[model samples]
Target: VNLLFSANRWEMASEIVDDLNRGIVVVCDRYAFSGVAYSAAKGLDFAWCQAHDRGLPLPDSVFFMRVEPQVGALRANFGDERYEDVDMQVRVRERFDDPRLRQGVPWH
Candidate 1:
């Protein structure tokens, strides 16, 4: 599944590059960082999770919206997905806060 996510990004590489070349800004809701963070939270090795996304175009800016786990759980449709549990979100948030994962990205 991680590979699939990376492949999905790779598949869009050409279009993304084209947009950049045309001076158009592109925004992605979830990029490679999310993949690594979520997978690492699920017990995958962090470095291994990051390996799959190596060489993908780096975003010019990254914004992380911090939300309390319980608060997030109260959001509408929060439980519709497999990883929506508050416990899982807490784990994922920890992973996202790791400085190693934020390296090289212009996080806001």
Candidate 2:
């Protein structure tokens, strides 16, 4: 499913490219980071998650914010979804903080 999620992103590649070409900024709620972090939290290898998302178009800027567990739960409205729990989010956050993920990206 993680691989498929990464693949599915490319399904909209042309449109995203076209929009960028037209000077429109694109905002993706979930990008490679989320794909990797979420799946990795679910027990997938972190490296494998990163491997699958390689070569995708890079964003001009990325903003990664980690909130407190209670904050995240409030923002996500706890129990409304499977990943809204504190435990899952903590795992996801840890994976996102992996040093490997910072090697080549401009993180703000």
Candidate 3:
């Protein structure tokens, strides 16, 4: 699934580069880092998850909007997805907060 997710992004790589070259700002809701974070939370090796996304276009800026797991669970349709459980959300949050994962990225 992670490989498929990365491939999906790779399919858009050229278009993203084109837009950037033309001075158009591109925004994405989820990118490589999210893939790594989520999969890592599920017990995948962090480096292994990251390796699949290697060489993908790096975002100019990365923003992580921190929300408490319980608070997030309160949001509408929170349980609509497979990873929506509060416990899973907590694990995912910890993965995102991992310093090794954040290295070399300008995260806000």
Candidate 4:
């Protein structure tokens, strides 16, 4: 398991998972799921996002935190912090609700 904050697609995650064939777990902060959400927010096809993540090592346990864009924006607000596009965040959150994204990795 690889930890990636702000998950991307499975291409990189799969590479990392494939690199480790031993009985050790690599902890990751984020993974392919992030890409699904972010890309979905961008109005990209959720299936396409998932397709890009195919063949990645599946996490034994997966968790998702359902959040609203406004909530996220408030929480992410920090002085001197680089800003994010709130609209994009909303789109990403919507993508998380996509059936494709809901399929794999039972959420905790």
Clashing pairs for model 1 are none
lDDT (Cα atoms) of all candidates against the true structure: 0.91, 0.82, 0.92, 0.63
lDDT of 2 at 86: 83
* Model 2 CA lDDT for position 43: 97
Deviating ranges (above 4 Å) for candidate 2: none
**Which parts of model 3 are misplaced by more than 4 Å?**
none
Among all windows of ten consecutive residues in candidate 1, which has the lowest summed lDDT?
52-61
Pairs clashing in candidate 3? none
Estimate TM-scores for all models. Answer: 0.95, 0.87, 0.96, 0.68
Which digits, one per residue and each the tens of the lDDT, describe model 2 over residues 1-108? 898898898787778999999999899877887888889899988898889778778787778876877687776457688787889988888888888876677888
lDDT, residue 39, candidate 3: 94
The residue-by-residue lDDT of candidate 1 on 1-108, one tens digit each, is: 778988899999889989999999999999999998889999999999999888888899999899999999889999999999998999999999999888998898
Residue 23, candidate 2: Cα error in Å is 1.6
TM-score of 4: 0.68
Which candidate achieves the best lDDT against the true structure? 3
What total of clashing residue pairs does each candidate reach? 0, 0, 0, 8
| Ranking of all predicted structures according to TM-score, beginning with the best and ending with the worst | 3, 1, 2, 4
Say which candidate scores most in TM-score.
3
